[model samples]
Target: MVGWVDRANSKRAHTLAQIPHEWIDPNVINEMKERGYVNTREYLDSVLPQNEVRITALTATELIERIRTRKLTSFEVCYAFCHRAALVHQILNCCMEIFFDDALNKARELDNHLVTTGKVLGPLHGLPFSLKDQVNLPGIDTTIGYISRVGHKAVKRSLLAKVLENAGAVFFVKTTVPTAMLASETVSSLHGRTLNALNLNFSSGGSSGGEGSLIGARGSPLGVGTDIGGSIRIPAAFQGLYGLRPSHGRIPYMDVTNSYEGQELIPSVIGPMGSSIQDLELFAKLVIDSESWNYDPQLVALPWREVPHVKKDKLRFGLMVSDKLVMPHPPVLRALMETCEALRRCGHEIVEWNFPHNKRMIDVGEQVYAADFYDEVQEILETTGEPISEYMKIARENISYKGHSGRALGVSQWWEISREIRSLKEQFLEYWEKTRDLTSDGKPIDAIICPAWPSAGFRDGDVEFGCENYTVPFNVLDYSCVVLPVTQVDSAKDIPDASHSPFSTEDKKIHEYYKPEMFSGMPVCVQVVCKRLEEEKALAIAAVIEGCLANVEKL
Candidate 1:
């Protein structure tokens, strides 16, 4: 009686047989499946080695400053990012659970406690962090892409994986997610579509699409994902990396696992992705220096607060180009107007945001996220008749098939959709405090510049229009955004706008699912945001607009 397609092909062959057979290469994965396996960092620079691709291109604060100065050895940066996350999860099926001998026996006990106490057991000392299959890792199996949560084992361990294993890091792997991580597009019948570690025919943006295709293919350098709407900034803006969505209680979702598992009306926090923006503020400053709200009493003792620099031509951002409902495409609106006119020619002050509370916070966040209508994941897929994934039956036929299963929403209609989500967060904090009389020096505009997804990645069933018109009104105004990775998909400078105009029918299915040379080189992100608990001023305005998006995408 085993067939949820034989338990999703034995949970994807026990996650590529936990990847350690000397990092398999069946002839460089059969010559990139005969020349069609579109680059996962050139198939991990043709199968790792070269010092495991320079220790998986170090960056979890450069593998914790060369493993705290002894020139690297937390068992050589956790056996070179667990052998480049076991050869990029044996070809971008971006890992779900691969222990690598339990992260090389916890990086040889943090290299025997930093060679017997020469110090460094905390600030992520051994560095190798990755986790998104909904965090939890007692004995593994956070089957978030649930075939009724196969083999089920997370008995304990998930308070952000025991605060990044009590901050000396090194967790090997655990990435992919979609099923009950509830779709952005990480596909699943257990793990069939994680791809795009840089254009494997586009889309590695999920429910933290396997920590954005394993740290956008450097395979684990910094990881932690979960974003309510933009699942950790649409897989770190579809694998160009540098994510974070922190706000709801400022990081710490307690014992994790969520597919609306107790949907706190747009909750889901936990942040960080990769390709360093200083390891996305070193994984939100080691989970706010583990004052993790005095051990997760639903976090917010809010420390690690150092966001004081503001002189990049006296800040003032606000931009929001087009949430007039999905317009961006043309290399994601030319990487947001060439990184907002190169951060206004390296002086900043962009203004124009006006966000009249995005259609009543998307009409009270789609009736308080479908008022518990996902019926405990369709009653655990009709009591385990399981096997579900045409991208979750196209997200239950694009949400209109909600025939009320476990039926929720009636504590006086969920307290009147929680007073219309607290009056759309007080009309989005009175339109972000009246954008300080339209900024320039007014303060109410240090961050906003939008577009996390209009088009930069999409292909696999394109999850039937789901990036909720630009990262779900900051997950219904819990704000504190951050997506970064500014430019790509240029097809000789991203064209497509044969004089257009649509704004509906999902903006003409995103302008016929855009095609400047068919998403030429993918990755083109943006989203800074801020406010609500302002994650260190939205990652310090995405590290100064990624240092002026590398000299404005070289013009």
Candidate 2:
């Protein structure tokens, strides 16, 4: 990989230097105005009164119940969601494209089906869901952050979209992603930046940022997003939503636009995001139980297992105070401490486990993330003569700073590293298995708790030294991980303890940014991680933690 890197670097010298600085072509902007794609100000003025229905953030199950009982028509539900989503896009720049008319028409048909047949189409019938732009929809442009793809459209819908459509879930709009879907902050030449809904000044987190902002704002009840690095989980964490970066292959990835098309050493997974965990589970089961594998051959055929019957009293958990790579920010640290305390008070055994080699896992994750030389990314950008967006350029530099030795491992070194990674997996599992003998019930931990990211959401462009490895390492191990927002940054309590001093310059910088004033009110989250393919167990554990927090709030 290193050798290829030096060769690739010598192969090109900041070619983005030649491109113009503006976001889009003036002609394209003019053409958009001519085609009625102008600013939302004029449109919203005429369309404001029509936005009468504003639905609260309800779960799919609740929405389905309402639709079935005739309290809410399918058309009304879809329309309400579309109207709010358009308003969200206007403020946050979330949607890459909107299809309110088509979505409302589908909702009408679904309502008629329910009325005539006296039966809903599926569990998700009439519920509105959003998608990350990479997921294709027939006849809808899927410009996954490329200028040239502005008018691009797919001939067929992606398997995920098709599955949702068949299940009667209405999609009114597709959200934006960073160019190449590589950056943590969402911005693209095609649609510009997607800001956080909670505080427009802060990042929503990406490449699923737009979806995060939309869901965070209650514009949509549920959304589908793809995760490579911290794509789904990061945004979900930032926006205080529940997001699952399921084990790779558990969900289909077929037909999605990828930053690295064929680099398969570390694979990306598509997963559900929503305002609540139950909704996350509902969507997860709805899609998986639909036997999605039949359509997307790449998807694992694993059906959603029934919720495991596990008693909290009998359950054991492993807890890590820190990954020991980059320490989490003070607010994040406080949340972890609070969570551990809450779980302990709940009568669950919490065993401390630390893995020193975690930084190595993070290293390997990054190596694989950029393994493609980003060839496909540059090619995609060049296609439209679109200047690489600031986010992508920044991402490329961050990846470059890892200092590729300008050396590639021989076939033998590659095998050695692969073997080492496999060995590490077993080693980690061994540590886990040993917990069974020492824990209260002599049972292995049901799940392990850890920080989702170093901080709630770092300042834009502040990811020069990426801490995404905290989440991405799970991706490498294919561990099932879920992000749960447990607490908000409390200016009074989340203050930094700089007296201890920094371990490195970067560590100091990380610490320095934890000023209560800067991070106040950002959602501080934790991740529930379980062994590979143990999503059911992981989610159950997440629920346990969530319950503990709720109980504490009651007190």
Candidate 3:
């Protein structure tokens, strides 16, 4: 006896009564099914090993060894990873798109090539990898979380993708990001939010949050992430994985999509992320050594060098446990203390480092980053009709409304600010050089140990969280930074000292927001940083820290 309008309203009310409706529109579901990917179970079974096989935690190195020894075929390895990636996406919302068919097909081709040639196609042959939604893969959509770009596929591959494909690496999937790819957390109108693997209630750091979550869950052996600010390092640290924001120009950026289409003063760099330093080194060495410069003119001509020069007995290090602007949370503080103690036990000299000029660096970087007034960024948002992500709302407060400043600054102001930044960089470098005279053997400090952020994996939509500038300072200096997981958060010890005072209003908010129970079991990490163009040395130092901590963990 109900009228049609009344029945329609009843259905609508019922839908809203539950958790947000995840309706797969009939047209979209049909398209997915037609492509043979809507139900991943059958495809996964045909291409992957069974669930009981214990293939989840294997590193890229171990997988390659298994493939080399003929204990596992390339097809089987790729299959296991694709299946795992599908499962991870289901739970974490980490994947932007799945490409099992292409990856499996590529794996079979690698197997045949190995049989005929008696040699692997390249270092990463048959390795399954995921890319940040921003990186372009040929014939795959790189919408970057915007509905406007949803069906727009790349005509050519990104430099990194091309390099990996040429190395016979199987690119199975791409992951999600914020709408403009500028937020501190990943959530988009297109693919939705990516959740933390350790706890679903927390955020995976963005704009590479999906990559961070996917790689952290062991869904992909490795991934490619880009950073201009703390994009790559923050996510990796939150996820307890290794990530690098190499010196500008270290990795080529051709065919990649970005919010700042033409802003070049502080150009973003593409880098690799993995669960271990060894895996990171493998990807970096193979990709750079492939001479990708021939395809991307922007790439520096630096070849990857497996340098053997981390002398543990003679290394001197500067430690920045807390930035003046924001004191790190108790867990991060404990990790720094633990790391310092471990280094001292290993005979490495540590020098106290307190940087007061960190604020200026943050200010300058913010100005330069927002110099275009966010014109291109605003345009992208307007085109997609998606609301700004929360992290970006904070950045917009510092930049302009509508998400950017469209006006240009006077030439004189621009020139003066540029000089100020140059002076700051020179001053930092000088301060670092002075450490050489303080060293036992008069050698410059090999690297600096600093907190990657103020805290580990924050609760979802934590806009008031501050202290991310720790990683941003290195980016301002144009130096390379590698994130290494130091320990796991323990609620019993990481509780807040409510009786103590805060450094600032933002600092207080961040401090008061800490709930030990909420963040328990999340990984605590730090940044290992070196001068520009010292990637090889920086990574080697990171490896030393990783090895040192691993040794401590065993005891």
Among all candidates shown, the one with the greatest TM-score: 3
Sort order, lDDT high to low: 1, 3, 2
**Tens-place lDDT digits, model 1, residues 1-555:** 786878888888887887767677756645776877677776676656787688777677877888788887888777777777777777778887888787788788888888898998898878888888777877778888878788888887778778778888888878888788777788776677877787766678788888888888887788888887778888788788888788889788888877766668678888887886777887787778878788789887968878667534468877887877668887877777888888888987787886766766765675666676566777787666865556555544545543423356678888887888888788777887788898766777767888888888787565665556788778887888888877778787777888878867778877877877877877788888888887887787788887777776676
Worst 10 residues of 2 by lDDT: 11-20
Question: What is the clash tally of candidate 2?
Answer: 5
Every candidate's lDDT: 0.77, 0.75, 0.76
Candidate structures ordered by TM-score, highest first: 3, 2, 1
Q: Judged by lDDT, which candidate is best? A: 1
TM-scores of the models, in the given order? 0.35, 0.87, 0.88
Q: At residue 27, what lDDT does model 1 achieve? A: 67
- Residue 442 lDDT, candidate 3, scale 0-100: 82
Model 3 pairs in collision? 373-404, 373-405
Winner on lDDT between 1 and 3 is 1
Clashing pairs in 2: 1-408, 2-406, 2-407, 3-407, 3-408
The TM-score of predicted model 1 comes to 0.35
